[model samples]
Target: MNAQAPHATGRQALFANLLFWGMLLVGGGALAACMLVPAWLDYQAARQAAWAAHARNDALARRITAQQLQIAHHQRDPQYNERFIRQEFRIPTPGVQVVTVEADPTGIVAPADDAERAHRPAEPVFPAKALATARRSPLLAVFVLDQTRPAVMALAGALLTGALCLISGPRRS
Candidate 1:
């Protein structure tokens, strides 16, 4: 009986040790899997978002190109500036003057005749080059797209860091 007791004690001790190690391994594996799996999901999401952003940027580039083509077409026309001025400012040409005739005596104004307008020289054409220069720079869209990349990277990096922290942290208690 005494010999059997010792043998049983030894077996019990071995079982206890095995259980402890098994629990440690299982717990650690679960922790690691939990952390890593979520991180992978986040990475995938970020990659998809980045791809979509790239598509959007490409579309924007196409839109800008179309706008540039339209602008070029307008610029190529010799009378574009003249039409623009006439439509925008409602300014009459030098020979075609605007005459005002006041119905009331209180207003002092008189309408002029066609002979005065005939002597006047034609209105000079307005140049578009100066207006183009005054407009905003074309590189602004590229700069904005360039700036967004870092922010997207930062978001994905943060998610990875958080997942790592969860995996490395001590179990429940």
Candidate 2:
């Protein structure tokens, strides 16, 4: 009976130790998660923003490259300016006269009511240069944040979580 009593006490102590370690691990994990999740989310947001900015910059660069190529082509071609002018203005060549014939008012009548115009969809205008100029680079913004309070907060949270975890570890008998 005396030997059995010691065995039961030993089992109970072992159980208590396991439970204590389990609780400590769970608590430490929870604390670390709480500290890390927001920072991780913020980092992801910043990364996504940077990627989006990079995509936009890439698109702009492609567009500028295309435009530059077109300009270079036009500069190289002697007849390009004349062709452009003729296409744009519908100007006749030398000794050629232009004639305009208007349709009879009775035969072709314009819409009398303003409702038709109001219901029509407006033309979609893309002012690419304006948009590009207006937007700040996401990489630059991220760099700024890295140098600011948010980065410090994240670092401090990580350090604190690590310290807590170490403190909560199983003790040596």
Clashes within 3 Å, all models in order = 0, 0
Residues 67-140, candidate 2: write the lDDT tens digits: 99999999899799887889699887787777789888788776666445434544322223222322354433
lDDT of 1 by residue, 101-164 (tens): 7588678666766445434543322223222322343332222233543454455455555555
- Rate residue 88 of model 1 by lDDT: 92
Task: State each model's CA lDDT, in order.
Answer: 0.55, 0.59
| Backbone clashes in model 2 | 0
- Top candidate on TM-score is 2
User: Highest lDDT: which candidate?
Assistant: 2
Query: Looking at model 2, which ten-residue stretch has the lowest summed lDDT?
Result: 125-134
Q: What residue pairs are clashing in model 1?
A: none
Model 2 error, position 69 (Å): 1.1
Candidate 2 yields a Cα-based lDDT of 0.59
